[model samples]
Target chain A: MDFFHVLVVLLESTIRVSVPLVFAALAGLFTERAGVFDIGLEGKMLGAAFAAGAAAAVTQSVWIGLIAAILISVALSLVHGYASITQRGNQIVSGVAINFIVAGSTVILGEAWFRQGGRTPALAEGARFQTISFPDADMIREVPLLGPIYADLLSGHFLLTYLAFAMVPISWWILYRTRFGLRLRAVGENPGAVDTAGISVIWLRYRAVICCGILCGFAGAYLSLAMTAGFVKGMTAGKGYIALAALIFAKWRPKNVMFACLLFGFLDALAIRLQGTPLPLIGQVPVQFMQALPYILTVILLAGFIGKAIPPKAGGVPYVKER
Target chain B: MSTPYAKLPGWVEYGLIPLINLAVAFLVAGLVVLLVGENPLEAAYHLINGAFGRGEYIGFTLYYATTFIFTGLAVAVAFHAGLFNIGGEGQAYVGGIGVALACLWLDQTMPWYVVFPLAILGSVFFGALWAFLPGWLQAKRGSHIVITTIMFNFIASSLMVYLLTRVLKPLGSMAPQTRTFAEGGQLPKLDWLLSIFGLDVGTAPFNISFLLALVAAFGVWALIWRTRLGYEMRTMGHSPSAARYAGIRESRITVITMMISGGLAGMMALNPIMGEQFRMQLDFVQGAGFVGIAVALMGRSHPGGIIPAAILFGVLYQGGAEIAFEMPSISRDMIVIIQGLVILFAGALENMFRPAIARAFAMRGQRAAAVVQTRGA
Candidate 1:
């Protein structure tokens, strides 16, 4: 392949790998911006992936699988809301508990239903997501830079990838421009002020968490239905945590979240690409070090060795109104 | 505004509540078992029998408990200072490196007693150093402890993989583990100690490290309750601003608390490395560090409470393995579900039933008050 082709392939893979991270990071943004710390994003995504894969395999419909995934994700989010908000339990502990519960439940239920080593049976062609190509791609291919960009880089991606990128600007507008978004942001920073303005902090927080669940649902669905044929054990891996790190690295802004996810995705794709290739100075860089780069970078970012990251003021604290 | 359950006697608060929570968790686990087409009671019986039916089983259970106790205390100590140290897995992993180094350098020349103390010191030093950075960041840089510690776990695993494969793996061996320690470097099993009491443990992995765990627990109890440093740490946890006003150095306490916590977690290497395997390997820490979180939460961050909590989990681990072996339907992953259920009930939904119980007690109190009023009238 030519250098241009290589660049196009690398960029395409980066976008493909980053789709889930983008969804998950945006999911985290909604919750954290509304004053709830969501360490359980990993668990919710895992649950949705399993539900989506199992449903699609059975129903032979990707739409049905997407709906099943969202429903399960929302259900898990409600459990977290009830525990952390209504019960006044520790939010971190609740998130951690959710992670454990969902991680175990998915495997157990998957094993019971499928009897396939905690994995859903692979979906057939009609049941899985098909790539969407831009119209008249063959005719457009001779048009130089725009042609290659359209036909090679942008075309033929799973529908979820476009949706994930679209959600970035949509999320930014909602978080920055909309009235509900204003209240969500205010509640995260100072719930007492929002309550004084007659807004119900609990309701606002719940709405944000539900939004988070929906985004995580899409993220999980994308993983199982579009990126892969079916759900595997721990398929989300540490992406949820990585998305969380990206969320913090973005300083909890919607646009920055996209950039952060793309950066991580690029790192991931580069790690895979460079696995066997020898470099100039370092010779052949070990794959483990490359895989660990994101986490190490996240730690350094968090430690303020680079830029400062300030969390929402009321993030971990459950608001209790005075009588 | 005081709830009746909150006004319960001390024993009920500390003992009965946890017991009830454990019962609820097990009930949920049983429901899950039933859903999987197995008899819950039969599975429970097998679990209990496998965990404690024979002296050998008991020994293995205690051996598992020893590691849990160390990790649990590690979590509890940091928790008392209002810090969440989730990097125990990483700390323990690096601690293994320390043990390996000590054994590698001293095993051939030095006696076991001399080598063991050096290894213990090495483990403690490395573990403490691993935790110190995160604690320092949380104290000075305002970084979240949970995020940094979790990040460290991944780093620790990757670092170990790199070290084992590239640096530490013995030449000409394909296995990803170090050379076995010399006979002098290995810890003696506790068989002789048990035999003195006319009890046989049947060549279990139980070793003198279990005694070390007990001693560490007692030491933690004393540190948290009987010392001024512990007092300062508790004050800092309860109210950071108040602690600052009271002349406690927040950063100092944070660092010290994490160091002690990491040291405790590091000592877990003694059981798995020196006592059992006699060689360092990758992923040796397994999920024990995460399980320590559940243990500390269940134990309410007290060394006294952690012991029993650790033992309970030991039963789950040993018993769960037994059940997996006997039952074809229930896989090893089911044990994880059970563990998750316990964590959910004990940690997250700890007070779900508290208000109802309090209301029930309040009604009884009101009725007695009305009877007294009527009798007097």
Candidate 2:
């Protein structure tokens, strides 16, 4: 295959892989920007993924399941926020508990509902997200080097993939150019300033967390409805944590978050491609190498070794009224 | 107003917090059982009695308790250093695999005493190595311990599954498990001692590993409160800046703390090995490392406090497994529902003072006198 054609396969796979992480990272960005520690994003994603898959399988409608997923995940988020924000509970414990709760509960619920023990009933065609194809694929394919990649990679993705990409700009707009953005960033960096400015800090944060829930809803849907079309126990895997890393890597900026997600997605794409492939002198690729790639990059990024990526100063610390 | 509540000692202040936390967890567990349509009080009773009830039950629990003790202390040690180490699940598994390999391959001909300790040491080496990666990342690379540790858990689980199924499958059988430990590799039962006590201990599933656990706990306590390295850890936990200024090498302490923590978790793998079982099956450590997180939390990150917390969990685990027999469809997973809720409630301080905090917040910070009880990390 030509370089352009090779690039196309890379691009297409990258986008599909990046979508869930993008939604998750954006979700993380909102929560962190509102000053709530959200190590629970993994749990939220898992809960949402299970709900979306199960609902879609039952209703045979992806859209309904998507909505249900958002609601269910937001409920978990409420639990996390209520603990960390309201009660000033330890963020890490609450997060781990949520993850554990979702993990064990999902399996128990699945066992009760489907007799499958650890998985939901697989969804039929109407319940799964359909891949979209360009109307003028032939024309687009002939345009240029970039065009070929775009035709192959950008085409035939789920609608949510497009929306996930669109979210980068949307998140940037909502977090930078709007009133909520001002309060959101202020609350994260300086909650006292926002509080003194007459804005309700808690309410403003509550909205951001809600928005995060909705975005994560899409990620969960993308995983089950589009990525695999079924729910497997612990299937969201550690993608949510990767998304949190992406958020940190991007310095909590939406556009930058896109770059980080794509980088991780590329590694994921490469990993998949390398699976079962024999290296020239090195022999079969050790799967562990690929598995550790994203985490390796995360450590590098978080170390500020890849330039300075400072978190919002007050990111995980709860704010209270100070005299 | 003139009560000791106005001036409790530091250790008691922190120590009693976990006890209260356990009570809070029990209350929440009761509520969860209610949701499951069972009698909360009755279930709680069964939970406690089942754990310590019959000689058989205590036999089972004692067999299981060592792992929770090790893993709980593992997490608590890291917690003392202000690091939320969720890598226990992975570390314990890695350690178990190491113990299995050492007995199954290398130390098969060694004397029982040498082979047993050697297997445990093998576990520590691997567990420490596994934890070393995340610890290094957190210390040198600025990665959040929570995130890195979590990612390692996935990597560990998948890698273990693949290895067990592929590289390490038993030769004769296609089972994804190691052959039993060789004769000399297994620990000898303390049957004489059990009979001498007249406790009527059956087959002696309980081993000297329990004594090792108690020793490790007190050992950890002394390390943290009475030693130089521990002083650095506590200082760093309270304030990294002060620790650094006080001539403690913060980065080195981070790595060393993780190594010790992971080594402790490695001891969890030792339970199955040195026990009557004498070999670890896949995830034989099971989710003990994860549940140990709750134990570490409810124990309020104290070495000694983790014992009762782990005992409570062991009872619930043993009892919850029995529920599958009576209500076949309900299955053993219902215990998870209770466990998850206990972790949540035990870790949630707001739940402890819910009514008071609710009233205080309702008044819009009016009743918030001083408000200085920041949550533990």
Candidate 3:
């Protein structure tokens, strides 16, 4: 293939790989912005992926699978809310617990139900998400750059990819312009002030967590129903943690979160592409180094080599009134 | 959160609360077993029998407990200083490199006693060095410890994988492990020790590392409770501002505490590397490091409490394997679920039932007061 064709392929793969990270980072954005540390994002995504894959395998409908995934993700999110918010428990401990519970239960249930060594069966065509083609794309195939760009780079992606990219600006708008967004931000920074203004901190925090769950549900479904054809044990594979790093690197802003996720996704895609390919001076970049780049960069960024990443002021502190 | 059990008697606070929480966790786990068409009581019997019924089983259980004790103490030391060092797995992995190097270099020349101490020192040094950067970042640059430490774990795993496959594996070997250590570098098994008591225990992997774990526990207790540095670390944990006001350098304390924690975690490599495996291998630390978090929480960050908690988890692991072997219906993942339940109840929802217990005590006190008042009138 030509250089332009290679570039197009790379960009396409970048978008494809980034879709899940975008969804998960956006999910973390909602909750952390509302002052709830969400280390359990991995667990919720894993649970939803299992539910979606199993349900889709059985029902032969991706839409129904999506719904099941959302319900399960929301249930886990509510459990986190109950533990960290209502009970005033240690938020980190609760998040860690949620991760362990989901990680264990999904495997047990998956094995017991399917007897497939903790995996759902390969999904049927009707059950899997199909790539969406742009209208009349074949007609313009002979046209120069625009045709390939439209056909290869943009078109024929899973529908969730489009939704994931779209949610970025929508999230930005909601977090900046909406009244509920203002209240959510305020509660995270200073809950006492919000309570004095007569808004219930508990309800507002719950709403943010629910939004987190919905986004995580979409991420999980996209993993099982769109990106792959089945569920595997630990398929999320620390994507949740990477999303967390992205959230911190973005300084917990919606637009920055999208950028950070995409950047990390591009790095991941590059890592996959560069494997076994010899370079000029480096000879060949080891696969392990490429895989570890994001985490190492996260550590560097967190150490204030770039800029300070200040979390929400009241993050991880369970708010109590009249205390 | 201030423990709500502060007003309760010591036995109730330390002993009864954890027992109740453990009971509830097992009850829920039993329900899960029942859902899978198995008898919960029968499963319990199998678990107990598998963990402690035979001398060999008990040896394996304690062998597992030895590793847990090291990691648990690692976590507890950090927790005491307001740092959550979740990078024990990584530290232990890097520590294996230290043990391998020491064994590879000195085992041919040095005696066993000399080689053992040198290897222990090497492990502690490497583990502390791995933790030093994150601790420095948290102290000097105001980075969050939890995220940095977690990031370190992924990095360490990648590094270890690279080292094992490319650098350490001997020529023509298909496996990703170092060559076997020289005989002088290996630890003696505990079977001989048990035989001295006139009892024959089967050949188990239990080894001298268990005794090292006990020594480490005593060391941690003395360091935390008796030393001035330990007192300062606790003060910083309670209030950084207050610590600063009282002339304690929070940054120094942060670095020192994490190093010590990392040193303890590094010691966990001894059990699998020196005692049992006799060579460096991938993932020998397994998930014991994460389990240490649950152990530390259940132990209330005390050395005394951590020993028993570690043993309990060791039982679950050994017993769970037995259950998975005996019953095809129940997978080994059930043990993970049970571990998760215990972590949830003992750590996150620790005080969920505390209020009820406290209220009961309060009501009893009020009734006694009213009776005394009536008699006085």
Candidate 4:
């Protein structure tokens, strides 16, 4: 392959791999922007993945699978909302509980329903999301520099990939421009102020959480239906946590979230490509180091060595109304 | 929800409330079992029987409990300082390195007893070292302990995998683990302890580490309840501003409490490495650190409560395994479901029933006072 071809392949893989992270990071952004510490993002994604995979396999309809994913994820989001918002419970503990519950129940339910040892059956073509091709891609392929970039890098991708990228501007607009966006941000930073303004802090927080769930559901469906053939046990493999790291690394801004996820996704793609390949001075890079790079960088970012990551002021604290 | 009312008795506050939370958790777990088309009561019977049926079962249950106790104490210690050290898994992972290094260096020359103390020192040192960074970051750099510790866990997992596969694996072995330890490294099984009760120890890995865990629990209890440092930690936990006013060094106490918690989590390596596996392997911590969170929540962060909570989890784990074998439909993940519920009810939603309970007690107190007034009149 030529240099251009290899570059296109790498960039293509980067976009594909980062799609899930983008969705999840956006999901986390919505919740944290509303002052809810949602470590349960992983669980919601996992449960949705299982639900989507199972539904798709049984019904052979990708749309139905997507709907199932959304429903299950929304249900989990509400559980988190009820615990942290309505009950005024410890948000971190509730998030942790939700994570553990979904992690375990997904496998248990998968085994009971499928009998495939905690995996859904492989999805058929009708049940899986296929890549969409842009117009006139074949005729443009022979053209030199831009053809491969257009055809290979950007033109062909699952519909979700475009949507994931599209969500960046959409979320930016929603967070900064909309009325709900202002109140959500206000509630996170100062629920008391929001309350004094005659707004329901609890209801605003729940709406943000539900938005987070919807995004997470899309991320999960992308994982099981588009990225892979079917759901495998622990397939997310800490992607949820990485998205969280990306959120913190981006300082919880919508536009920065896209870049952070892409950066992590690029590193992942490069890691897979670089495995066992000898390099100058470094000899051969260990895959473990590459896998750990995102987390290590996130830690450094969190430590304020790179930049200070100031979370929403009211993050992790339950908002109690004073009589 | 915060109503100033009559103070609750010790039994109601410490005992009845926790039991109710636990019962509710189990009830939810039972509903999950029913959802899977299995009889919840039947599953419970199998679980209970599997944990306590045979002498071997009891041995295994205690063996699992031993690990939980160590990790649980680790969480409790940090919790008392108002720090949530979620890096127990990473600390314990690196602590295994400490145990492995000591065993590898002197297992052939030194006896088991000599190696044991050195191993303990090594585990504590490395484990504390692993936690010290996050603690330091939190204290000095104003980072969140939960986020930093979680990052450390992934880092620890990566570091251990690299060490085991490329650095520590024997010359010919393909597995990513060190070779089995010599006689000096292996801990002796406590067969005599079980034999005293006329129960055979069987093939269970119950060993002297059980005693070590018990001793550590006692030490933690004394440290948190008796020592001046313990008093400072509690004060810091309750209100950092108050602690600062009392001339307590917040940064110093935060660092010290984290190290102590990390040291206790590091000690958990003894049960799996020295007592059972006899060598370090990849991912040997195996979610035990997360289990500690649930145990601490259930135990209410008291060493007294942690012991029973640890054993109860041990029962769930052993029994869950039994159920997995007996009924293939219900996997071992059932225990994880139960664990999450326990943490949810006992920790996050702890006040779910408290308001009602408090209101009931307040009404009773008023009624008794009215009765006394009527009698006097």
Instruction: TM-score each candidate.
Output: 0.96, 0.86, 0.97, 0.98
Candidates, ranked, lDDT? 4, 3, 1, 2
Write one digit per residue (lDDT tens) for candidate 4, span A176-268. Answer: 999999999998899999999999998999999999999999999999999997899888899999999999999999999999999999999
Answer with 3 or 4, whichever has the higher DockQ: 4
Query: Number of the top candidate by DockQ?
Result: 4
Clashing pairs in 4: none
Model 1: DockQ vs. true structure: 0.65
Say which candidate scores most in lDDT. Answer: 4
lDDT for model 1, on a 0 to 1 scale?
A: 0.88
* CAPRI class assigned to model 4: medium
Off by over 4 Å in 2: A2-10, A136-152, B1-53, B97-106, B136-141, B155-179, B189-205, B241-249, B276-282, B350-377
User: Which ten-residue region of model 1 chain B has the weakest summed lDDT?
Assistant: B1-10
- DockQ, model 4, C-alpha based: 0.79
Tens-digit lDDT track for model 3 on B1-377?
A: 55334399889889988988889989989988887778888888889988887878888888899999999999999999888898988988888888888888877787767878888898898889888989999999999998998899999999999999999999999899999888877887788766776545576688888999999999999999999999998988888888999999989999999999998898899889988888999888887888889899899999999999999988988888888888767877887788778888888788888888888888999999999999999
Across A72-101, the per-residue lDDT of candidate 1 in tens digits comes to 999999989988887777788788878887
Which model scores highest in TM-score? 4
Q: Give candidate 4 regions above 4 Å deviation.
A: B1-6
| TM-score ranking from best candidate downward | 4, 3, 1, 2
Interface RMSD of 1: 1.7
Over 4 Å off in model 1, which ranges? A138-147, B1-5, B193-199, B368-377
